[model samples]
Target chain A: MTDIQININNKTYPTATQPSIANLKLSLNSNEFICLVGPSGCGKTTLLNIIAGLDNDYDGEILVGQQHTHPKIGYIFQNPRLLPWRTVRENIELVLGEHQSPDVIDALLEVMQLTQAQQVYPERLSLGMSRRVSIIRAFAIDPEVLLMDEPFVSLDAPTARQVRELLVKLWQQRPHTVLFVTHDLREAIALADRLIFLSASPMQAVSEIIVPIARSDRGNELAIESFRQQLLQNHPEIKQLL
Target chain B: MINLKRFLSTLSLLVFLGIWQGVAVYLNSNTLPTPEAVAKVFWLGCVSGQLPFHLGVTLLRLVVSFSVAMLLGCAIGIVLGRNKKLDAFFDNWLVIFLNIPALVTIILCYVWFGLVESAAILAVVINKLPNVIVTIREGTRALDQDLLDMARCYHFGKRKTLIHVIWPQLHPFVMGATRSGLALIWKIILVVELLGRSNGMGYQLHLFFQLFDVASILAYTVAFVAVIQLIELLILKPLDKKALRWRR
Candidate 1:
């Protein structure tokens, strides 16, 4: 069965003169990692918001899973939206709820290397540390689908690389359907099973390129570079975004 | 730095007292009593237990009225701030209440309630309630919609959302309301007591006014002001520190 199905016929912002997105349709298999690449302000975040049910102002429907129930959605926003008043542990626990086991929380904290920082408040954390906490928060619920909106956009290169590697490792441990959004083609090539390219504003999928290499193999710099070259050669318009 | 701050504060108070003494000596009138005379009366009041008794009565009225105003004001403010329909409906009403003089409200309550204790307390509450509502409503309106969206995405139910997400963001506003409420309510209580009730610092002040006893009046004012300052230092300051510790 399809893990998720999204069919947004149209979405328009009241302030904008034009519809932001229309005729946007896609389906994903369970555990598939799909990266959406688009120019800035192309309604990629809007699409993600629609799928996550954070927005419902659009036309058409988004159905998750065979039963069409509201699937457990974990969203990692561009900025770590951690409550400044809450400690890192409390922020994670907020999502985990009372029923989740302490062991599960401990494991997530350990994996994120946040065990020591758990007691500290978000304001005390550096940007990278806060982002890691946000990732840990997303994973704590063991969600069926994870939606990330430019989760590493503003980080320093080294920190971004490390976080991406950590994200891949975490995903491998217990795979879930991921809809990762980024403007970075190389990052998309490295993480996604399929790269979905979106048009400029009022976005819809222009094309989709399935990465032939394995997720583990895509991490190799030379391999991803070659893939990036091939993608630019075939779809020259994508180079404009870089 | 801390020592310097303390020294400067003490120095300023001494300077103020010195000026007062100099003025009293120059005036040489019973109406403007000397600092020594006021101090003597203050000591006598403390010894006679009358000062503490009236001060306690005033403090009780302040507490009851302030609590009621804060609780109800916060609830109403949040509701109005969150709902456009309700806010529009009551926006004019809030303005009307806010503009209505505190003295008018106190007098009306006394007349309507026939000089009862509840009337005094209610008068203070009514006087203070609008300010609390205004402050909290502004806070509620300024709440981060992004955080609220995050809460909704996580499926935090109403109770969890209120406690964990909503309340923390609203803490500063609540504190703002509380501080202002304390300042405003205490003054209103004094007025209410003076106008109606035969007890509390206000009543004592009224009696002193009839006898033209400036020294006792100044003593009562000093004692009450000291207690209010003590409450601020002992209770509000510590709570403000703890609540905003994350800011550090």
Candidate 2:
């Protein structure tokens, strides 16, 4: 099993008045889906950046597997950052380069329901369609680890639900470690195998909840509500966030 | 609709010429020749081949100087925009070059290089380079860092990042530099040619001036302006439309 270890001693910006993250430690097992729940501005994105190796200002060490080499990371930002000049298909193909086959891209376009829009540029796409393209881009890389920073935050309920279900299906097809950051407690409960809750600014993990239910069973509305209620009872502070 | 636009443009040009002809007739001075006289002289020069040869020389100088300035300026501007320390160090130098008058630079180059062709092109480049650098530097500074982060996360190599991520963003700025550079450099080259080298449109204009031939001077001016407009319409406009087709 691939084990990932994260040890963040502290991270602060030169202009900031306080550290963004302090003494934050976590680990992940192979193919485990973890959700990080935190209040807004709790440095969740910062933590993701650190893990993605996008930010090196932090005092931390992220050890992925035994060799400590970084795993191939797929990141989906809140807004789809597709290149405006590139068509939807090209944007996905950009990350895969020559390694991806034509059939794989065709399959992905079909699965994402973007077959008709494959040739369209990003500017012509609707918000939901654009985000799907972004998701397609992230998955096209076949990343060993996926980091999603509130991928469904601003989306309408129906679109968000669609994307969430699509994400689950893709993950099941090819299981990989996923660290999803979202403030939506219900969404966290529904998707994550384990949920890590962080306190406000200068974030540190305050609680961890392991969902005993299987992924398929967790989709039921009753089960998700019961899990949310149980979580609020155990960690009352999380109730305020919800 | 396109035909309407073409018709309106031609009508506007006709009106401008009519007004110019009216004023020239009223003045009845050799200095302000009528449009017809200038056109006649222009046709004669075209037939004699002097006008085309001199225009070619001036066009060559313009192309060479413009390419050199743009290449060097874009490289320097991007580096300055990316590096804060370097930008700070060179900020004063940029200001100094920008403030130096175009005439002063032209005269200084001619004097130092002894009226050579290189000196003439160098003078034009010096006049145009600072403006290109400033425009491109601002574009580089305004680049979206979020997109850059996305590129990095995707593991796009340096080459891909430059071509796909960076170049598209910088293109508008490059176009801005090119248009303004062409406008300014052509004018400076004329002055350089008038002051120094002897084979360009500017040198011919100086000859016309000595002979008090207002018709020949006006003919040269019209011919050069037409050539510049043709280059803009045929080359630059199409490139701009194609490169920025995504904006539509």
Candidate 3:
């Protein structure tokens, strides 16, 4: 894995009232957990869309690793976004393609605690369960770059925490460059190796701070909050962006 | 609960048959034959192979025209739905076709193409295609973009994306078209047959009507209605079950 370099001069959406993204430059290091923290409606999702090659209308360049092209991408949208017709196992298996059997999915489903829901369709799943399936689907493909857009935003507390732990565990096992976008600073501090704060419309990175806490101690909620407090005190410039 | 529903259904059908028989006996005329007279005619027609032959011919026409219309409509609908400029250009044409009467199209196809089998089939398909296109076009417009994005990010190829992501979203609309199309196309096919074709249920019905054989006409009608009812039971119900299995 290598760093993902994103350089955008201007991105004006035809439908948007304001400029979408302008003069945004970001570097996500190889196999590292990078979180982008910004206020809601700040065009973070649009940026992720551009990086994932869903919206190519933007005037920008996204380099996955060293190559100026999309590598395999695993994206988790803000909502669960699972296909309602497909069962949980089938949803993950779909990404594996035709040649590969679903044998690999068994272990991952076990890890995500979704083995029981393998045959259950998305409609029957709880939001939390559906989110886990989405996570599993992304991980199933073994993507080179993973992009997540506020995946844990609306879930209940315990469920979100559990999914976060599951995501960290998955990343620990198969390390890849992750560009996680969210407005929750505490959540970002809890998960990131480095946190990048972004400004409002025409999004540009305002501040970049390396999380001081070790990955080993990130599970401690109190420690994460204290570290966030200390980091905010040291750098008051990002407070406004947050 | 299922058994109770079945019992009620049987009772209603029996009551209907009894009322029809009672009316026929009260009238005591060949114009309004008893249920038994119609039943004998139906059995004789079946045994003599005339009813089966005409029914089979009509069914073949229904299948061919329905398949062609649905395939053409769905393809055109997707194209119109995805391309805004093309849709704008073609919107007036679709509106014109939608408003054109089925009888007019059948008559025109017969007049222009002559009383050939292809002309008859073409007429049914022409009458049915616009409705399917409009229904499927609306469905395509309403598709969830988030799911589409998910499909794109995962690199589901065009074929996989169409089958897994696109088709399920369009299934309800397609089903709507299919049921309505089946209802409509068969009626148009019968008219096509009555106007020009030498065989099929419509031709047979015309022959019965000319002879003033009410029993034979009712027999043929009963056979056609039974086939439709059978189609509802055997084909549509199971397909509906499969499509909606994902729902709660």
Candidate lDDT (C-alpha), each: 0.88, 0.89, 0.89
lDDT of 2 by residue, A66-160 (tens): 66666789998988899999888888888886756767788778888899999998999988888888888888888878899999988899998
**Which ten-residue region of model 1 chain B has the weakest summed lDDT?**
B179-188
Q: Worst ten-residue run, lDDT, model 3 chain B?
A: B182-191
Off by over 4 Å in 2: A98-103
Candidate 3: which docking quality band? high
Worst 10 residues of 2 chain B by lDDT: B239-248
Per-model chain B TM-scores are 0.97, 0.97, 0.96
Every model's TM-score? 0.97, 0.97, 0.96
Q: What are the DockQ scores of the candidates, in order?
A: 0.80, 0.82, 0.86
A86-198: candidate 3 lDDT, tens digit per residue = 99888888889777767779988888888898999999988888888888888888777789989987899999999999989888887888999988889999999899999
Q: Candidate 3: lDDT over CA atoms? A: 0.89
- lDDT-better candidate, 1 vs 2: 2
Which 10 consecutive positions of candidate 2 chain A have the poorest summed lDDT? A97-106
Using DockQ as the yardstick, the better of models 2 and 3 is: 3
